[model samples]
Target: MTICQNVYFKLKKYVPDDPPEMGGLFGGRNGVITSVAFDQGVSRSMCSYTPDVNRMNAVIEKWNLKGMEFLGIFHTHFLGVRTLSEADKKYIKQILNAMPEYIVQLYFPIMVLPERDLIPYVAISQKPDVLIQKEELIIL
Candidate 1:
């Protein structure tokens, strides 16, 4: 069997003193992984706060040239909600509508109880008509 390489996030910068909230948000721009860190207080329920389109576009542009694309999005799940929700699907549709050529990736950070470690589950979608492809987990 052939296996594909999974993409991971790299935080460009961050501010300290953020609360310990439940959620995750990250994005890749122009083929480079950036901004994978999230403000813990921004999560609500089983979903992380969605960034505004205009704001997101601005961030993508800051890291990429005009007409460049967003590669993917990543987020965390709290309270054991690891699967994508209806709202997440809607956001995926909106992202595809905004950048049809870009692949959108989603991540769920699973916190294994008792062990106290976080494991990430990743999914990637290339187009609206295609099914989301999940990458196998590999520990590094």
Candidate 2:
């Protein structure tokens, strides 16, 4: 999947000097990411990101009205953490399983500070096992 550089820049603005992760919803059409929504600070921390489901659902509803599909989520990791932690994997599984039947979830781990780049860490629940892939994240 490809994400617009505009989206990356938007996320860059939220990078914190200290811990306390920040993230928000992303949206686009037909496999191309072009829009992202980050508002203040939803509900998150250094090691976890659990935004208000009600508010997130509302955002999805609003995006649907605009003809954009929900394109999973993006969040910043704690400083120096370039890989997803066990907690991250668990959360990814939970979110992927909770998505609507037709929706395939994707999660991007945006590294903070010294290593500022969005890492494509996709999580898909494939029946008996969950498949997580670290693939190329094209920033256009």
Candidate 3:
């Protein structure tokens, strides 16, 4: 998965040494991430993030108008959690199940800070299951 420089920079700001973690959504034309929607009203906790539906929808609407697809979610994990937790996989499975059959996969990228290490994964929607696999993140 490839992301624009601006989005990469923005993701770096999600360092959790402060308290709660941060999260957002990102997508673009083709397969490169050129647009990102940061949820200003995101419900953040010590180890969880729930997006504001209204805010997320608003951004999706704008992106749709501009012909950009909603690829997937981007979240931050506390330092040392370099991989997706079981909870994360469960939530992603739910998302894939809820999505229309036409959509085959969604990108789920995690940023682990303060190292700001980005780990990318794509969730493949396979009817009864969603398979999460590692993806190489390329910054452009």
Candidate 4:
């Protein structure tokens, strides 16, 4: 399994939809993604609401049951703001501080303009420094 394969599988799960605005854990096998966990903020943001601490904890527990590691945090960037925003950086730092044991992965789903196309863009660092390329997608 290579990074390409991991990205393909991960992208497959969220396509053909409005795209989720959240973060979660992911498990990669031989560099291939095997599982994904969408963050709590996703649903909350959908309804223009905020998530409570307890709710966030519950979402984490749900992912824990799946036995996947915190691969990264992913959220949809509407309005073409594909770059990691200041708020995104802040949250990443907070998440890292709160869970220093795991090497968390970060992702940003860029929903292309008027068309509302969902493109899976990912970065591993606090900033959008790394862009997962299409060639990385392993045919598998």
Q: Against the true structure, what is each candidate's TM-score?
A: 0.52, 0.84, 0.87, 0.50
- Show the colliding residue pairs in model 2: none
The most accurate candidate by TM-score is: 3
Q: What is the overall TM-score of model 3 with all chains considered together?
A: 0.87
Q: How well is each residue in 1-140 modelled by candidate 3, as lDDT tens digits?
A: 88998888877764445547667888798878987776533554467766566776678788889999888888777755888888788878887787667778989887776677889999998779788999988999
Q: Over the stretch 57-90, how does candidate 1's per-residue lDDT look in tens digits?
A: 6656664664544445554444545556666566
Better candidate number, 1 or 4, judged by lDDT: 4
TM-score of model 1 relative to the true fold?
0.52
- Model 2 lDDT per residue over 64-88, tens place: 9999988877767766567777866
- TM-score for model 4? 0.50
Q: Give residue 5's error in model 4 in angstroms.
A: 4.0
CA RMSD of all predictions: 6.3, 2.2, 2.1, 5.9
What's the lDDT for all of these models?
0.44, 0.71, 0.78, 0.46
- Counted clashes in each candidate structure: 0, 0, 0, 8
**Segments of candidate 1 deviating more than 4 angstroms:** 1-48, 66-69, 100-130, 137-140
Backbone clash pairs for candidate 4 read 4-136, 4-137, 4-138, 5-138, 6-33, 23-39, 71-105, 72-105
What lDDT does candidate 4 reach at residue 60? Answer: 58
Preferred candidate (lDDT higher): 3 or 4: 3
Q: Per TM-score, what order, best first?
A: 3, 2, 1, 4
Q: Which ten residues in a row have the lowest lDDT in candidate 1?
A: 1-10
